[model samples]
Target: MSQPDNPLYKTETASYRERWIGFIHGLQDRICAALEDLDGQALFRTDEWEREHGGGGKTRVLSGGRVFEKGGVNSSVVWGKVTDTMRTQLKIDGKNWFACGLSLVIHPVNPYVPTTHGNWRYFELYDDSGNVSDRWMGGGADLTPYYLFREDARHFHRSFKDAMDAFDTGWYPKYKQWCDEYFANKHRGNEMRGIGGVFYDHLRPADSADADRLFSFQQANGNAFLPAYLPIVEKRAVMPYGERELEWQEIRRGRYVEFNLIHDRGTLFGLKTNGRTESILMSLPPRARWEYDYQPEEGSPEAVLLDACQHPKDWVK
Candidate 1:
């Protein structure tokens, strides 16, 4: 809910930003590479966009792939004088800020392969003299299944919990709960967006040594993305699905759309900051549906997914 409070080591502020930009861009490439390899038939289209203010980002979108229907891997390195809206939202008195991050969303073609999303970001606020007064890191990964798969959910949750437990034994459970709460669609009966994963923020460094520790933690989570989601996708991508399954997927995607537009802070931030609208909305599915009085039959797989959402599980346990 809150942001990070650690200050960037000031001795090499420019160098740090450079390194972060390099890492994020590199992450974007590596993830795209993996997706391209997995997809085989489709390739990602890259768009390098410049912000109106002072920075730019590379957006890579893959569609109609062998496995995935649509996916986006994007990285942005931007900085500017904090706007009044940002000042109000972030509640910061700082004059300027810098942000760099990589975000990704993968929607597999088959309903068997659950949709997945993850992001990792670094941010800083600075004074007039260009000294970093505050800095932080935030992100997490989660899975949304049209057909609930217990093993898949457990593996996804366990993978992130391992990444967090390596840093703090308490972080896994704490942030696992945070994710469930944070990604909910409150207007839709408090249903979760997905099977929960560890979500953390305001990871402030207590000392200089702690900064490196947090960075490594972020890298660990980011690197673990493939392992967490790929196996499930590989198993399910080629499984046969009929129109009924596809219909449920689209219906579930309606809820995904609802959560993003109605509650996602990322969408709000991007729109408010005048960030590229296309790239921000690339998270949406290629197709979705909303039907009046739609209801899944009891004891059906679709109903099972809804039941899971209604009553979240402790996947790792």
Candidate 2:
């Protein structure tokens, strides 16, 4: 990755660049504030760091709270020369690149409250002459619950569906299915990480006009995060739990870890490209457990979640 050659950047590209950077940064602040209020007991500690090769990022983490056990909301802006491996992964050839994105993950104290992950990003590739060679925008949100709740799942999906429907009526189904396909543990007989929300990437604009429209669509979905997730967190966070429930949460978190470490592209991209280890792995839960092929008792809540993960449901229809 390489720094943005400002002198060669087109005027329009610079505007969108500033727009996305401001948007993600603003979202980080807003989400952190809302989560702090929801917890009512803890504040996120901030760590501002600079990437040794290029740009820097701000990582804010909250831990050991009344509601949220651990969580992170991070925003980063980085640019540098592209490498051969990156070219192979991205399937593009360029000497330089610029990327900006916001990534977040939240794990709650109550097993009933589902864990969630969401990210939005923009990428641009530049040729040796510093001219923009390609650009795309991508993002989505999804849910993972230890104890399946039909209504909570419905609420979360509905919030995002409504957001996308406002932009394109057909996008909900397409993106929803895409989400199910993208976040899966295929090695484990195609089990999913969560109930599914919307996931999309490489959303290149069809025309210059669509660029702003896509940006607005990104805003709509990004803004939808709080309503989609916080309401469920509010309802479930206060629910009572015990050692058994906590144990189950950790066991399920084990799956979350496997997916992120072995299957997640973001984690891979970050690690391969020299991204900060702490910020990237912040998506992992504070606690996790793995047993020797541990199986939940028949009809147990844990089994129910696994069932949903194996056979994803249509939450909205």
Candidate 3:
């Protein structure tokens, strides 16, 4: 696919904060619509909820589909007084804070089709007089396939690389390395969560013009998600799978659950800030299994996946 253009750059009259909020909400709608069309048999059920402290969000989920077994595309805009918890856990030194973002995870029923995840968020910290003190942007898209498909992994990584290269030629390499490192089960010998794509955090802009550019960059990545993933889903969603593939998928999902609960800062931040319990944990797969001393046979497809996890590949290059 071609590199995505940043049409969202400098096109809005709204303030930077408002522009991000509007973009995430609109993105949620667009993504849900496209996913429904892809699933063919399932629809998203939305829950519009408010946080007791400050802002609210819309959580849309789809379950029991012909394609996807369970998935969630959530948008949240939450703000409140910077509490002791925030200071201690998130290391913010502001009196007040505001945050908005869209986070999503799709778990396909067919093991041949990889599960995908993407998130794009913006945050601000305010001082005593309610002036913006500090702010930054964070997010990226990654793929987690139970079975290795070289072309599918390459397509997934290349699409996001194209998006980042439009912004900066250096970013794809930097963020791709960060993703391989960040989404790993460190306790399990640094095994990656998937054949990594791209990940970044704490992208502080130097000025307003730079901030607009960053916002546009974020939009570029967000817009790239469907293109990166949908084609792979379409290609593999029809492939046959049996009990063996299903078993391996669940076993790998168990590691996915491990990374989120134990190592993910997003999960830790949400819980520490009193974010919604249900929405915070929506990234978990519908089913997972842990078997003691379980290992795939030598030279098997499952073993190939395990090997890739242990040694992250430069898929795009």
* Candidate 2: segments with Cα more than 4 A from true spot: 1-12
After superposition, candidate 3 runs with Cα above 4 Å error: 1-14
TM-score of each: 0.94, 0.96, 0.95
Q: Which candidate number maximizes TM-score? A: 2
Residues 1-317 of candidate 2 have per-residue lDDT tens digits of 23245422543488778988999999999999999999999999999999876787999999999999999999998777788888788566777777899999999989999999999998888777777778899999999999999999999999999999998999999999999998998888878988989999999988879989999999999999999999999888788889999998898898889899988988988887789999999999988999998888999888988899999889997
Model 1 has an lDDT value of 0.85
The best-first sequence of candidates by TM-score reads 2, 3, 1
Cα displacement (Å) at residue 224, model 2: 0.2
The most accurate candidate by lDDT is 3
Cα-based lDDT for every prediction: 0.85, 0.89, 0.90
Candidate 1's residue-wise lDDT over 1-317, tens digit each? 01232223332466766777777777788889998998898999999998877678999999998899999999998777778998898576587777889989899999999999999988878876667788888888889999998988988988888887788898888888899998899998899977777677777777668877888888889988888988898888888989999999999999999999989887888887888999999999999999997999999999999998888789987
RMSD over all Cα atoms, model 1:
4.0
Native-to-model Cα distance after best TM-score fit, residue 51 in candidate 3, in Å: 0.2
